[model samples]
Target: MPKPNEPILVALVLAAGSSRRFGSDKRLFAYNGTPLLQRSLVIPIQLGLATTVVLKPTDELFLPSLLGCYLHHPLLKVVYADDALLGMGHSLSAGIRSILQSSKSVEGALVFLADMPSLEVKTVRDIIRRFDSNKIVVPTYMATNGSLKAGHPVLFSRPWLKQLQKLSGDNGAKELLKKNPENIINVALDDKGIFLDIDHPAEVPGAKT
Candidate 1:
């Protein structure tokens, strides 16, 4: 539970991608007996964060079949991004807009990618523990070769929400991060799962046909 005056943080899961690189709807692919997208949602939802999943406008045709089990989840909100094909930026913008429109108390949001199912729960908890309303919290891990690498589910504060809403194209938040380098708070994590995202069937340990 959050403290009386602690900023409210929401989880924005971006699932509106067409998965062109994966050659199909990778979100629905089975991973460890659960849909890949569902796997990605588990940790965030389990942590008790109000999560918003962004989907393509056309997902309505198969929404019932794809996410029926999660439709009634009390903490979940599903929104459609009509211009999802335009890229991840659009989906992210739609999600941030939905959060702001629905609640004024949300002072920050953790941006999650639907294809990243390998992320560890501890890593997420650590990020949440270090949340700051005035700074962006980014997770970083040391590569085997001794290089530092950044990871997913970045926490963006309220001041950056408007910029996120104005985002366009598929680049996502890369440009925003570059522009405000000083505002980022890098959290060094020991978990390598932070950098793992399944973009192909071969990437899964035992992918189904």
Candidate 2:
């Protein structure tokens, strides 16, 4: 629970991608013993965060079957992006718009990618703990080749939500972050899961048949 006057935050799981590169519905792809999206959502649900999952308008036909009890979880809400096929920006904008209209007192939102199930629970918690109402908190990790890489579930403060809502095309929030370099606070994390996202079938190790 937040202290008196502390900013309230929410989580936005972006699962509306068309998965053109994956050649199938990657969200439903079996990872370990669960669907990929379910794996990505476990940490947030476990943390009891008020989360909104953004999906394509067409997902209504099968989401209930894919998500099972997750659809009924108290902390979760689902919103569909009618223009999701337009690109990631449309999905992101729809999710942010839904957050703005919700009754919750949200001062920030952590944007998560549903394909990145490898992200650790501790990494998500650490990012939430480092949140600021005026700056974007992004996790950074060192790669095996000694290069620094920025990873997802990027925290965007309230001040930037409007910008996110106005986004268009497939670029998502890349341009916003690029233009406001000073507003980004990169927290270094030792976990490589931050950089792991299953974009191809070959990436899922120990995947269930």
Candidate 3:
């Protein structure tokens, strides 16, 4: 867990990847009139002052378009990842490093994806409700009768920052998630937003509609 003013928990939105599947700027795609990327950025910023974004080195053209039009918020700040093509692990590492590099005073980082606009701020607020000195919390939603679907807006406590920053390849926090099940406290939820991510152009319409 992190101290409130200590800037312990920062929102790391990985927005550097090219949306090859969508064939368009998935980050800028509008949902209910607001760009999905902008909403992603806003969710964390509105919750904490330490919210930061990770952006891949990209053409000045499209990057600026979204930043100005949608992601432009006073609390939102940008950190650059040099190689966006190295997959999600690189972007995740870059985002955590950016904060660790700028200030060691940070407690932990909370991670979210760019295309998941279905998640609510209350869901995130609930996830952060149990901030502590050394525990990781993850949200699990009820899937069906007695079944649970696991996902994130993951809360990484301070002790795991080193493990998270050392991540590579296509692997995400799953490795850690499996290794430390006891440390994980399930933040129960039932919303589909916990699993909704725009992977294709068709998903965009379904999520928004």
Best lDDT among the predictions, by candidate number: 1
Query: What is candidate 2's TM-score against the reference?
Result: 0.95
State the lDDT at 63 in candidate 2. Answer: 76
Q: What is the TM-score of each candidate against the true structure?
A: 0.96, 0.95, 0.88
- Per-candidate RMSD vs. true structure? 1.2, 1.5, 2.8
Alpha carbon lDDT of residue 167, candidate 3?
77
Please, what are the lDDT tens digits per residue for candidate 2 over residues 14-98? 9998888999888889888789888877988887778899998789989775677697888999999999999999999999999
Candidate 2 regions exceeding 4 Å error are 1-6
After best superposition, candidate 3 residue 42: deviation in angstroms? 1.6
Rank order (by lDDT, best first): 1, 2, 3
lDDT of 3 by residue, 1-209 (tens): 34546436777888887889888778778787777777787777777546667786664456666765434666677877776677777778778877787777677678888888889888888887866658887888987687878776888876888778777666667888889989988888867788788878687664442
Global CA lDDT of candidate 1, please?
A: 0.89
TM-score-based ranking, best first? 1, 2, 3
Worst 10 residues of 2 by lDDT: 1-10
Which pairs clash in the backbone of model 2?
Answer: none
- Residue 98 deviation, candidate 1, in Å? 0.8
Best by TM-score: 1
